[model samples]
Target: MAGSLPPLLLVGCGQMGGAMLAGWLADGLAPSVILDRHRDDIPAPHSVVRQASDLPDDFAPALIILATKPQKAAEILPSIAHFARHAPILSVMAGKTVGGLTAALAEAGTPGATVIRAMPNTPSAVGQGMTVCFAPPTATEADRALCTRLLSAVGDVAWVADEAQMDAVTAVSGSGPAYVFLLAELMEQAGIAQGLPADLARRIARRTVSGAGALMEQSGIDAAELRRRVTSPGGTTQQALEVLMAPQAWPATMEQAIAAATRRARELAS
Candidate 1:
């Protein structure tokens, strides 16, 4: 890896990519080149080109990010293969494994390209995202460190040794936000069922969930401990937990949901 990340070459500027680009800019990284067919609202100091050919002949980036959809990877990869000669490719696309990326580059005649796979959620937009990354054995320590810096710009980062674990990562954090959102939705509806006004229920549910999450983040306590702290010996919360933690209730259902998502992630990779 380079001592410092040089100018970045971002291949896509969709919602996720735009969030990261925004975080990087806010963190003072500038002089980046974005290659995308669709126009995106990007801050200044970062240039955007409609296509790879539009890039200046002399432009070389220290890092190249693959943020396009997995289905379009083959179509988008070739244009950026030139950057892989010097810069490492960091992919935020889900279900695309390291070998898959290497193969894509190989198909583009750039087998020497080093790639890292990252799974980051939408929360990255707020700089509080959880991003998990994996690098193949060929990636150098500096390469990993460079990726850590890049991911850390948006949020906390964790690394896994096994590439196969990425499927679980996808099921967990990758799709986890929607699960939380679903909880908020159900909570709001439940409040309404309990005779609360719809608008009040919605606001209360949203704030309660958000506040609990913030507390969990800052409290330096595990979720189980936090739950224990909140649930009295025989209180209403404990009563609710009895129902939610029932064998066929939330615990089992959540497990099944995550397992289904994990399977789908593997399916997409294949």
Candidate 2:
């Protein structure tokens, strides 16, 4: 276990929040006081409360993590602002900007709260996640370090100086996993179409995608270089690459997809 994490107050335990909690537990973080309207999914041993008003009067958390759904932020922020006054706020809700969070906290009576925005992928459940965060000027070095340590439990942590870059971050790592999954799904369907048994197609597609990703990571090689090494001048791999890399194909489509996601993120923040 890394040194004990500051006393933590977690505001939600759904999908992404639950993944981060699982990672924290795996890393030996002490149980946190969790606040959620629905408590069935919360694991045993960590204290759970249904409402902020139910918290003991003397309770104080050193870090408060906001993981509620973006739509729920308006309703939940007021309940947590007491904790926000004394602790740095780490938020993983998609499209909730730091300025917006700060304003919510202020409305709850904790003015100028130090708010940090983070975007983490679903892979965090398996300890292979990518997390990018942007902190306001009010956040101190210690505050940033604490946030990094918390995020590192699930996977890698990156800090961006410009909060505006967060929209791009959301489009990339935050939504990248779904794109990879779609590729795997399409590959399996293609294999089945080519006369392979359904089970065999599924197994091969999953293994090939996972193995290639692992190899790329372990070898520290660029993806394009790795792809090149596998393609011979007249090989099947080269033929497939030529089709996929056409001007109107994957390269162009991927850029358009990311742009669409980035625009949605900006719209949500507004």
RMSD to the true structure for each prediction, in A, is 2.5, 1.6
In model 2, the Cα lDDT at residue 197 comes to 99
lDDT of 2 by residue, 107-136 (tens): 889998999999998888888999999988
TM-score of each: 0.94, 0.95
Off by over 4 Å in 1: 1-5
Q: Please report the TM-score between candidate 1 and the true structure.
A: 0.94
Local error of candidate 1 at residue 172 (angstroms): 0.6
Q: Number of the top candidate by TM-score?
A: 2
What's the lDDT for candidate 1?
0.87
Measured with C-alpha atoms, the lDDT of residue 256 in candidate 2 is 99
Backbone clash count for every predicted candidate, in the order shown? 0, 0
**Over 4 Å off in model 2, which ranges?**
39-41
Model 1 per-residue lDDT tens digits across residues 153-206: 889999999999999999999889999999999999999999999999999999
